[model samples]
Structures are given as C-alpha cells and as structure tokens.
Target: MPNPPDYSWSVQAQQPVDYQVSMVQGLLDPSNSSLARACGADGVRKVRCLVVVDDVVDELYGDRFRDYFGAWNIEAAWQPAPGDETAKTLEQAVAITEAMSAMGILRRTEKVIAIGGGVVMDVVGLAASLYRRGIPYVRIPTTLIGQVDAGVGVKTGVNHGHHKNRLGSYCAPTTTLIDTEFLRTVEPRHINNGMAEIIKMALVKDADLFELLEIAMPVVDAGMMADRNPLSIEIIARAIAGMLSELEPNLWESVLERSVDYGHTFSPSLELRADPPLLHGEAVGVDMAICVALAHNRGMLSKEDTDRALRLMCAAGLPVTDAVFTAELVSEALRDAVKHRDGMQRIPLTTGIGSVRFVNDLTDDEIERGLDFVSQWAAEHREETA
Candidate 1:
C-alpha cells in the first residue's frame, strides 16, 4: 500500500480562513511542505527564505520543511539550535545575522520563517525584527504553549540574564500557522502548562467560556487519574476559539493587552521564588485562584463564587497552592505585581467574574488572606482523587 500522502496538501485547503488570530488553523497532520506552499502563496521564493527552528524541532521537522521549500522551487536555509537563552546574547544574534548576510540574504530579498515552540518564535522573531531594521516572517508553532499565547503575539524577545523576554520588539508575523498535529509529541505536563493560558482566558473574557470549563471539569479531573476522555479536546478548542476572538483583530491594542496579563504578574514571581521554576500553566492556575480571592476581598465576588472558581481549577487538575506559595511568598508576589505593572500606579484588581476594575488597591493584609485561602483549600483536598 502507498504511504499516506504528505501532510502538505491538506494544509493548503484550509489556508483561506481569515485566521484573524494570526490566520491559525489546526492542521490534523504536520505538513512542513504545505507550510512552504502557504508561505509561497504570498510570492516568496525559497532561495530568498531563511527558515529558523529550535534544535529539537529542526531535528524532527527540518528535513520536511526543507523538502517542502525545495518542492516549491524556493532556496532556503535552516538555522537549528537552542535559540532561547543563547539567542539573546549579542554574539549569537550577530553571528546568525552575519551568516545569513554572508549568504547574500539582504533586507529586501530575505524572509525569515520560524518553525518551533515559543522560545523558537521569540528568538527568530527577534532576528526578523532586527536584521537590516526588519524583514518579513511567518510562524509555525509546534507546542500548545506557542499555539495559544506566544505564537499569536507580535512581541518577540529572548531572555536577558535572569529576566524573561527582557530584550524584544513588537514585530508581527506575516502569518502564523498552527497545526495541532504537532502536539502529539508534547508531554502531558507541558500540555497542562499551556492550559494555564486557556483557563486565564476564561476568567477574564468570557463568562460562557468559564461555564463551559466548569461543565468539562469532570473530564479534566479524570485526565489526572489516567482516564481517557475526548471532552478535554473539545474544551481546549473552545477555549482557544474564545481567546482568538478577543485577540485576532486587536493584538496590538492595549485593551486586550491588559486583559491577557490577568494572572501573569503574580505567576511569574511565584516561579521566580520557587526553587524549581513553576511551569507557566501551574503558576497561572495559582494566580487565577488568587485573583478570584482578590475579587472576593474587594466585595466584587461572593464567597460562593470564589469557592466555585477554586473548585473548578482543582477539578481541572491545577493546584491552587503549593509549598512555594507560602504566606510570605504571596505578600511578596502581590507587592512585586503592583511594582512591576505597566505603570507603577495602584492597579485595579478583578473582583468577580467579568468585573475587572483598576482603583481598588490590595493591602498586604489582603494578600496574606488570599494565600491562606489557597493553602487551606490544598490541605482539604490533598488526599482526594478524581
């Protein structure tokens, strides 16, 4: 029997969707060649293209991307390496840029396409933003984290010393292609990492989404117990669609910008304070619960509402508290959140579902209360299994 047709052909058929969320489509199969065709549709020649990917992704998908570009009669070069911490170094960026320049890739003639997870996107996107001022580029995100958050945003950067994404630019991609097939290789823990974003979207934007999440809470809990449930997929896709609706057209707009940062402020600091950095999603889960508690303190959310939110998160297999989320840690995270905000002004805290205001400042006392609530919830449910 003939081998299955290459993943390329199927991807092209789905390209016309507006994908306002950066023209994303969940291709069922990984189609590197199809991606080449999609890029070429805009009239880019292969030889003029420089494809960049993380070392892992390059090893797994580079040949396929190369073959695809070749099939389209395009001249292409693939840069494969861990482009996260190292890429931010001037030496690394300069070296890569110099090599591409030596290959005769000029500002007007070259298009850099990134195919990998968020880190890959950040590094390559920075390269595209900086090379000869700027160059056109595309994004093919391969991880759940990338598909939902990093892949959609124009912000590109690499870690600078200890700070994450410290050096970067707001360079939007020409197009961003998301193929869910790439997730087959993703670990379950990382998938949970991505779910942090999904849950964050539900809390800040869509009451309906939050309700839907509650309905699927059982399936999510089951996932933690080694049970198989297709509902998890449906919930994930629904959550993704809801977020894309808010982000698609206004990616650069400030309104959605603040909304996206809902739980990130406290989340990052939690990770920083932990001996082992918390997974992005895990920290997000904790932050979301904290926000719900904050809302209650501000009298925007009732105790009942806060309890429900915490319960749902636990049902979704996210921990509301960890040893690292001690009372002292919570106070520090709260203070840091206010300090590190876009403006150092007293920021409003969200008080209920769909109610985010900016004037009610949280005191240190309130922060401790929030931390205690999470700790109590964790102890109560520590032995309970889905």
Candidate 2:
C-alpha cells in the first residue's frame, strides 16, 4: 500500500500575546485623552474605532462622549448596549457583532472600545472576538466589579440557558483602562458587590489585603472613593495588582488548581437560580463564606479567622448566606464545576488567611454542615446587628 502514501501531517503553532492595562484617573477628561494612551497616539488617530457604551453609562455621560473622542481627533462610532446581567446573552452578542460588521470593522486594525461594567465588557468582548474572526478591543470598566475583577482578566462570555458564563472565550483586550472615577457614580450596593471579589482575593492570596480590608471597610461603607479616600484607592490598587498577578501566568487556565477560583466553585449555579438574581460578586461572597466554613470544619482555618472573613463580608454589605443556597443547589453547582474542571473537584479552600489548598475530595455531608454553619452565623450576626 506504499505505507498509506505518508498522508499524515501536523504543524506546530505558537503565538506570544501581550497587552497593556492602565489604571488612570479622568480617562474621559477630554484633555487627558486616555484612549490615545491605550491605543497609542498614532494608532488612535489612524484606526477605525467604534465605542460600545453601556446604556446606563451613555445615559449618565452621553453628551460628553463624542466631545471626548473628538478631542483626541479619533472619529469613532458610538453604540450603546443594555448593561444589565440579563443582557449578557447570545442574542445581545449577535446584535453587537452585527453592528460592528455593519461598521466595516477590520480584523487587524479597527478596535471596539467596550465601556461599562462586567456585563457590557463580556458581551462586547465576545462580540469583538467573534466579529471578523477576532478583532482588537479595549475595555473601560465603569463599575467597581469591572475595575477589580472582570476588567483585568482575559475572559469574555455570555450566560447560556440558566448557566453563568457557559458560553465564553479567552479573548484578551488590546488594553484595559480602569478609571477609579467611575466608581464614585456606582451605587453603594454595587460597590459592595465588587468588594466581594476583592475579599475573595484577600481570603486566598493576600493576608495583607485582608487586613487592609478590615481597616478600610468602615471607610468604604462610609462612601470612600479613590479621588477622595487614599485608603480606598490603596485597597483597589492592591486588589487589581493581586488579580493581575494571579491571571498573568494562567491566562489560558492551563492550570486547573487555581487560587483565583476560590469563590467561583459553587456560585455560578446559585447566581443563576435566585429569583431576583444576585450580582456576580454577591454570589461569590456566599460561596466564599461556605468555603470558609468548610475550611474551619477541617481545621485548616481557625474559627477566629473564619468569623473575621464572614464579618468583613457583612461590613462590606455583602450577604454571606442566601435562602436559596440549599444543599441541592450546592450539589448541582459542584456537579457543574466538576464537569468544567475535567471531572475533578479541584475546589480551592483556605489553609490560612492569604493562603490556599486545593482538594478533590468533598462530601455531601460536609457541604451540608458548612451550609448549616453559615446559616447559623448569619442569624446570630443579624441578631447582634439588630
């Protein structure tokens, strides 16, 4: 048979990718020209750019957007997408993708500038990834959640049929511009929502950050903004740095045992199941609270440390327990997470404040006990506060 005519062939593909992330003040300060800094002075002027603003953001600052872009001599098309979690759907992504297609966006040049919280970033990022087989995009995350966690990661996705981020891609933005000024306009509850993700980081990776949160929570609760409160700014900077430090090495999640997954293991299901869906970070806080209890039960975390962690969540205005977070829900979440983790429960748990350990073995009884512990803790704390 002539050795099957030697028809088999394979080619190795390797591509090195890098992007810039800038945390700036007054990104839209017309005089500042932050987009130029993100896209490059020359590139900004030359590229065909489209600005996709979150509807909420456009409502708040629409009048200034055109002037801001024109100030830098960058003529760009502006499109607004609804910025709610419900908007993170395939249909919305298709709409944005179609809009970009209509605009004649090129795969290599013309960039899509995503401006809003995590949802807008997710849908727009996914749209940018799909349009023309992947085009460059920039993120200007407007909410606290976006600034700290979502905006920094090389992940983009839309929820699918009651599943959080079931349809997603690892498409890094050309640049991420984080302006703390935007947080000043975010509602207090939303600020607390973002704090949940930061607290997750502190619990698993930085004891110092945890301590900082303990000190800064009171100020944050009292309306701390980066422009007004140095401590608040420091807390935000630490959280962003910590997140980037963890993500830079595992952009593709090549490692299954991830410390950054600390609060994510069981939250996706809970987040989707709630009637009035919990914000992403709120769901994460509940998951982290359960993990804290799990660690305490196993003697990996001291009861004192566990209480401190739970208390911090409360002080930050995050819920550590939810009525809907039942044993069945947890089991379903774990099942879903295991499937995603290649049939292993590489669940991240705290060994100590600022340190983590991964365990593949978790029991139904243990989860029930953890849930009970958190429920009791929540009731007791509520009584004390009352």
Candidate 3:
C-alpha cells in the first residue's frame, strides 16, 4: 500500500476569449458582404454553415437566405425551430445538434448560425456549445430585443421544469451580427417588448439614454424604422453600446455586481408563471416597476423620478402592472433569485435615473410594501392615461 503512489497532478493555464458584436444594416442581403466576411466565407474555398433559424424567420426570408448563402459559396444546412419562449427547451437544443451532426458540420471550421429572435439564439447557441463540447457559432438577432440585449451577451440557456433559463451555459458566439432591417418585420408589441431592455439600461446606467428614450418613444410607438426616425436609431445604438460596455468586462459574470440585472432579478419567475405567459420584456417591465417602487420606499429615488420611469414604460407600450404579479409571486421570484445569486440576493436597484446599487438584505416586509406601492401607482397612472 505504498500510500497510493502519489498519482494526483494539477495543471494551471489561462486562455483569452474575445468576440466581435457588429451592427450591420442588411446582413442577409445577397449584396451585403458583411455576414460573409464575419463567417469567414469570403476567402475560404467552401464554408459550411448550419443555420438554426426561427421558423417565422424562415417563412419570411427563406428563399433569400438560400440565395445569399449560395452566392457566397457556402454550403448551408438550414433548420427552422419555433422561436417562442415555450419552445426554448432542452429538446429543441438536442434536435438542432442532431441536425447539425447529420449535415456533416465540422466541429472547428463549420459554424452554427442562429438567425432569429432571442429564443432561437438561446436554443441554437446552447446546442452548439454542447455538441463536441464546444463549437463556433454566430448570432444574427432579428428582433430588436435580441439585437440590443440577448444577442450581444455571452449566455446560452433554455428553460427546465417551471424555472426560466434553468438549463444553460456561458458560451460566447464567434460574432453577433445585428441588422436593423430585421426590426422592420417585427410586430408592434414585439417592438415594445425590446424596449424593456433598453429601458433597463437607461434605469441602471445611462441617464442620457433614458432621456433619449423619452424622446424616441413616440417614434417607436408609431412603428417608424431607424432610417425614417434618426432618434430611433440613436436610441438603439446607445442601448447596444451601454449593454456591451457593461458585459465586455464581466463576460463570465465573475463579478456579480451587474447593473444589467436591474429588471432581471425577479422577472424570470414572473415570466414563466404568468397565465397568459408574458413576454420576456413584459415581465422585466413589471419587475422594473417593482424595483422602482422599492427604491422610492428606501428614499433612493424621488416620487417624480419613479413616476417618470413608469410613464416612459407606458409610452413605450410596456406593461407596468400585471394581475399575476401578486405578493406571493414576488416572494417566490425573490427566493428564486436569491438561490441563483448564491444565497445573497444581489438585487439591483436604481438610486436615480442612471445609477444603481445592489442590495442583499431585502426583507419580506419591504417587498410587500413595494408591491402595494406599485399597485396603487399603477392604478392612478392607468386612470390618468385613460
């Protein structure tokens, strides 16, 4: 029994990972060379791409996509999966991975291209990460929400059981190519859905962006494209820049003091539990409203500021109140968030329009009071608007 012969060993290493998030106008257009270059299809003899697109996106631009890829000398395996939140599951990821494998996708050279909204990106990106342990992928976020928030981040996840984003990974895409042209086809409510993340950025880190949202809400509500409304473009640009600035340094979230979590802390449960199934941004809007009330209760934000924030959300057509957001639900969401944040609720709250503070000592009493305050405020605001 020679003391096990000392067989254990250790190795230490450091690896740097960097990826680009480019904003191009017409990424899928046959004439546009940006996507081709981003995927390294320009100089390559034959580039193989396994595209996991949202079913809706495929319906809208399938022929054009095929034409563009063919013109670029790339062999593409196009697979469309439902992009709804209900479809963001492990099963979908497995299907995409299996499809890619059948298409002869090379682990190192061939790329998995996720082309659609946030759900498509999450499922496909997760599949890409799981296959062969890791593989390259590109994100083409079609929805405004995907472009400004989900698409730029280095996170891939799917829902499990009753939890939102319970199954996931920290897999970064090779590149995130955002094209505003895709926003043109998004429905009005979906456009407003994307505004929630922009509003979150404004609430947590950019007062200037908040003011711009105030100005751009009317244009956005009118469903004007960025070309027609310059302010709209400016708003999108500022939101993307703010998100990237916050995420670039904390990609792995090694430091948990994340301002981007302002509206996200308690929204996951709310999003998953709603009867009508609130959109991701809609749930976030409700969560932000609650945090605004909590900040006001703590005297960190003025009543005027709180009302203004809520009003901006209203102008953007986002919901500030939902029947499903009861005190019990709030408590449950907080519990889930606390567990996710390693037992210390790293809840992000806005001290002002553009500043944030994370607190770990939130009491149940405070949550109840905040819920009451928001419910009252929402009632009064709704009457006024009516």
Model 2, position 136, has a per-residue lDDT of 90
lDDT of candidate 3 over 293-382, digit per residue (tens):
999999999989999998998888888778888888888888988878877889888899999999988888998899899888878887
Backbone clash pairs for candidate 2 read none
Per candidate, the number of residue pairs that clash is 7, 0, 0
- Clash pairs, candidate 3, are none
| lDDT by residue (tens digit), candidate 2, 1-386 | 36555577799996567887887877778778667756444534454588899998998877776777666666688899999888899999999988887888777767888999999989988988788768899999999899898898889999999799999888889899988877777989889899998898898889999999998888684246547467787788889999999998888988888899999999999898876679999899889999999999999999899889889988888888888999999998999899999989999999989999999989999999999999889888994222
Per-residue lDDT for 1-386 in model 1, tens only?
99987665434332222333433343323443445544553334435677777788777777766656656667777677574434555455555676567666767645677877777778777777788877777788887778888887778876655455657777777777776656666666666677677777777766666787777656443233122234555555566676666665665544433666777756766764555656667778888777777677768888777777777777666667766876677666656555556444234355666546564356678778877766766677676312
Residue 76, model 1: lDDT of 75
Global lDDT of each candidate? 0.65, 0.86, 0.87
Positional deviation of 216 in candidate 3, in angstroms? 1.1
Best by lDDT: 3
- Stretches of candidate 3 exceeding 4 Å from the true structure: 1-8, 222-229, 383-386
Candidate 2, superposed: residue stretches over 4 Å from native: 1-3, 39-47, 221-223, 383-386
Relative to the true structure, candidate 2 has a C-alpha RMSD (angstroms) of 1.8
Model 3 error, position 125 (Å): 0.8
Model 1, residue 49: distance off in Å is: 1.7
